[model samples]
Target: MTVFRLPDLGEGLTEAEILEWKVAVGDVVTVDQAVVEVETAKAAVEVPVPIAGVVTELCAQAGSVVSVGEPLIAVGVAENSETARYREEEQAGSGNVLVGYGTSTAHRSRRRARPTAPPPHGRVPRVISPMVRRLAKEHGIDVAALTPSGPGAIVLRKDVEEAIAAAARPPETVDEVRVPLTGVRRTMADRVSRSRREIPDATTWVDADATRLVKLKRNIRNTDPDARVGMLALFARICVAGLRRFPELNAHVDAERHEIVQVKGVHLGFAAQTDRGLVVPVVRDAHRLTLAELATELARLTDEARAGRLSPADLTGGTFTLNNYGVFGVDGSTPIINHPEAAMLGVGRVSEKPWIHKGKVRSRQVTQLSFTFDHRVCDGGVAGGFLRFVADCVEHPEALVTHL
Candidate 1:
């Protein structure tokens, strides 16, 4: 029997919560077949087994957190050349983790059943991932009845969600509700609390006439309809430019070192709300990207965030952040800074409002931009200047050419 231990996922992650097991005891398995899904502080990842054999034992129960280097699964294998080679690879440290490990194309047919008894049809549901199974099970929906929308006729999370929407849910009576914070939500709470406790933070706001920016996007689209330059991308460009002018805002207050380390490039992060929770995906080297390039990257990251496919590297090393709460149709918000990042810029909704244009009252597109920063990094004057620069770019996008 070969014991497969949980290797480090990445970014020094020490523990992961067992989401579900793909295989059970007495089920035959192959090398590199994903045996379980685990949720780390950063993201949800599938861990694969190295040896090819029968699953003897599962080390931990679902929903339990397992530390790194702990036994995850046990596989029984025959004493042959292949088994010896696998053991040798494990000794060399390549067989424990998924990263840098190669998977073989040779795999036998595998089968898995729900924790409960087989359905009336006596066939297992063709589900794509453990998450989809969990979603269907949570809603008490029959997985086999749900139509598959994913490739290869596999049931996806969206299919389960659609079924849930169509099915009427009966209201339940309950007392006070309590939810244990786990996974990403838990990490977010810890970071926010730490930021409030350690950093001296302040907020500043300004209302800008976004009519010109709106017109600019329309003009660009008219020239090339394929250019999906969104408002958030334009705001990202403006924020990157502002950071170039005020490098202090693009820095971290290293209390241990008693120094302010200015980050080298504009690794811009933006807040994206997913079904799991709020996640900020960072775009590295934003200063070097064009407006169109920024839009593409932002759209890609947003899709990855919503689909729960973002990796640990895609979510860290952010020097600054852009929060577009405008999507929620809110007027303004004083958001807490993403811990360790020096500052964050929040953009409110762009709505039609009465404004003075050329000394005359007129209806125009307007928005409020809120800036939050750690006071230890810079004074209010610098914060105000950076906010003003961003506002000016929004009001008069022509000024962006100078910064570019």
Candidate 2:
């Protein structure tokens, strides 16, 4: 029998909640086939089968939380079979097969710490785990050059402290700053810091007359009684339509690999404000839903998120994100892109203003639309066009009604 443990999905992710199982006991599964969907703190990811065999048992049930290294499933293989023979050979050090997230037996061995002694033959020495040694090799760093500061002559985490720290100047004392880095502040700080350091962002703002849209929403609320469309719903609808026209905006920047991934589907993320922090629950396939449907989903998602009942799946797979800072009494602001996504739109509050309408000064509800995009994937022209499309849609609400 082959035991499949829940794999580490990402850095620092220890446990995951089993959201669904694609296979059941007695079902045959092939290697690398998706067998379950697990929800972690970061996102919902599908776990694949590690071996080809009939599932003998499921150790965890749906909605049950499991930690790493805990067996999730057991697959039964035939005795003296090709897979079993290969496993025996692997146990004998003939190279183990890496399937799904399975690690090799070589990684399971414990390393002995170095003894306290003077330099041996004038050679530098270091103590580290087998995993750290492999990581050092992959990073082209000399492990022997590092000093071990851990107990029992082992290299603890601090041993890899910044190489240039010794030569750096000490900082002068300043006023102490202390604040709780939890909830919204922490998330905003991390996102903004990363965006400032990693992404080359450029923002464009366009002031548009949203009078027609506001009037349309008011009319809908009055007529339907059950259908209440807000400005955010209209904005989401406009963004979906704009993406169809300019698909390049609906993309993600893979900075590590230096690639821009354009997604085909429209998973729109709406920034919902709560007392704790701002949560963005995504509406999968927002383009497929009508304005009313989008409004309803947005309402439901916000309600669930505020109630702390949002599942991990509701937060992932967002191709585009929209932040309505206008609801907070802000006129306009540049919003940071959700990591892995290339662009984000900030919708400002709609306020009545006097504007020149066909050679006459008239009152109109004007709102500012801010588009912040990763310059690496999008240029000024593309970003401007997307903003213009949204502005046009909001100004002419009839267009959205006809299109939908």
Candidate 3:
């Protein structure tokens, strides 16, 4: 019999809740065929079986949380057949964990520890590869200082050396009543804790006359239902322009290294509240996308996020963030900076308000724009300038043509 354990899905994840089983017992699975879907704190991921054989038993039922090294399935093997060959490969060779990746026997097995070394930073000195250990030793770096971006908190060499180079840096649970941090909520707590602890943040906000911008979106609203350019999309465009003006906010501080790290392109992350919880879905290269393109992507990602179908990649790699809290019927917010990124631009509700137009009192669509930034990156002068530029774009929508 060949046993398949819950393989480490990377990123120091400890356990995952099995959502569904793709196959039943007695069903045969080929190499790399997904047998189940498991939801981690990160995302709902489908787990694939490594070797091909008849399913002897399903150990864990749906909705049960299984630890990283616990048995997931049992497969019965036959000798003198194709299944036997696969079983041979499993025993003689490296066992595949994630789809398209394998864990070599040598990689999984541990070598004896050196006579003397630095004490473990965490609960235990994380099980890491010999090469990773050697690299840490050569550099005189603590393995514990190197955060684990690998499976079950094992430190990756890239994570360690990045310490050498520049260095760099949720689900929801519960219901109508009070709930506990089981899934996405727990994930967000850890992240927000890190963001608040490491970042020296500041906030600035201003109200803008968005009458022209509102009209522009309304005019183009029905032009293409597939690609609806709304207020958020326009604000996104303005943010792209703002980032161009103040590149400092587009950067992050390597706190350990005490150096500023500026990102290359703008992977714009927008906050979307879903049934699961608050999640940020990123649009890659927001600077290159047009208004319609940005709108389509926003709608697509928002829909996916709401449905809980967003992949881990869809939720990460944001160099800057654009948060539109106005949809919640609020006027302003002191947005918490999405960590690793230096700043977050928030937009409150755009509603009619009294304003002076041509020296006469009139009603205009005005909105509050708030910017929270890393004080380590720039001073109030730069933060103020970025927010003011956004306000200017809202007041004069025609400026977009020139800004673009």
Candidate 4:
């Protein structure tokens, strides 16, 4: 019997709440086949089996949270050359076998075992456990150079810890506080890192006279006292209009296929600060929704996010994002492009500012708008046009009527 641990469900998520099992004991499975659905703080993800075999055990039941490197399931397989290699991977915790969100892919075959030999003078040692790998990675230790004390020259956790201690023997030290990054925060960190690494992003900003937009909101509320229209919904409508004008910004690059995919409709996402963490709840088909409808949906999603009741579907598939950092009492931000999305528009706080209006200097309601775009999808011209259009609509709310 081989025990398979709950692999790190990307972004170094330490634990997941098991939602349901796709297989039970005695069920036959294939490599890379999803066997269970688990929920991390970020989203619901399906965990795949690393080795093909008959299920012998379901270690954790639904609604139970299992941490990384803990046994998830046990599979029974007949002894063979392939089984031996799979066992090696199971012991080593090869994370490549861990599938991505909601999908699985083919697993890479491991090399056949070589004759037993000592570690070469100038080679990295063999790492055989996830704990050791994580320990070394966290401490910036070169496992290859470490002298392993385990059998077959496998690097162990103690080896890594010892190396870390030796390197960190500081002459002067204070009590250090360590906070573990788990769940949503860890997932967010991973995505942000990937976005910065993969995206050639650029930002442009403009000061917009939001006096008309604010007045439009008041007029609508006056027309219908029960109308739920708010500043965020108005901004969502503006973003939808901007996307319709510049469809290029409503798309993502398919890095593997070497293609740019233009999304069909606007799935508008807005950043909301929730008790769990920061989450972007998507408003699907925002283009089809009326201003009032947009307000209603945004309000609903925000409530759901705050209550920590949002599901994975509520958080995925956003073609464009509208970030109102102004709610946090900030004036402006050069927002990061949400991974897989082409652009995001950030709104600063709307305040009374001195401005030239009707050819005269006056105090006007103004806000700064910052647009950040993935340069890979479009150049500065397209990004500039989208921001300019949004700003124009903000200055003259009636301009949206032409597009709506």
Clashes of 4: 2
Which pairs clash inside model 2?
Answer: 326-349
Of the candidates numbered 1 and 3, which has the greater lDDT value?
1
What's each prediction's TM-score? Answer: 0.57, 0.54, 0.56, 0.57
Q: Residue 152 in candidate 3 has what lDDT? A: 43
What C-alpha lDDT does candidate 3 achieve relative to the native structure?
A: 0.79
Q: 1-404 in candidate 4: lDDT tens per residue? A: 88878765666667666655777777778777777876564555677775777788889865466888898999897787766876686577666534452223665223221223444785644544554566688889988888876544555556777899999997776789996778667766777789899999999999999998999999999998676898998999999998998999899999999999999899999999977788899999999999888999999999998987888899889999999999988999999888989899999999999999989999999999999999889998998899999999999999889999
| Deviation in Å, model 2, residue 399 alpha carbon | 1.8
lDDT for 272 (candidate 1):
95
**TM-score attained by model 4:** 0.57
Off by over 4 Å in 4: 1-176
C-alpha lDDT values of all predictions: 0.85, 0.75, 0.79, 0.81
Question: Tens-digit lDDT track for model 1 on 207-297?
Answer: 9999999999999988977768989999999999999999989998889989999987999999999988998999999999999999999
Pairs in steric clash, model 4: 124-144, 125-144
* Candidate 3, residue 330: how far the Cα is off, in Å: 0.7
Which of the two, 1 or 3, has more TM-score?
A: 1
Clash number for model 3? 4
Candidate that beats the other on TM-score, 3 or 4, i.e. the better one: 4
RMSD of 1: 28.4
Candidate 3 local lDDT, 135-165, one digit each (tens): 6788777887667664344466666677766
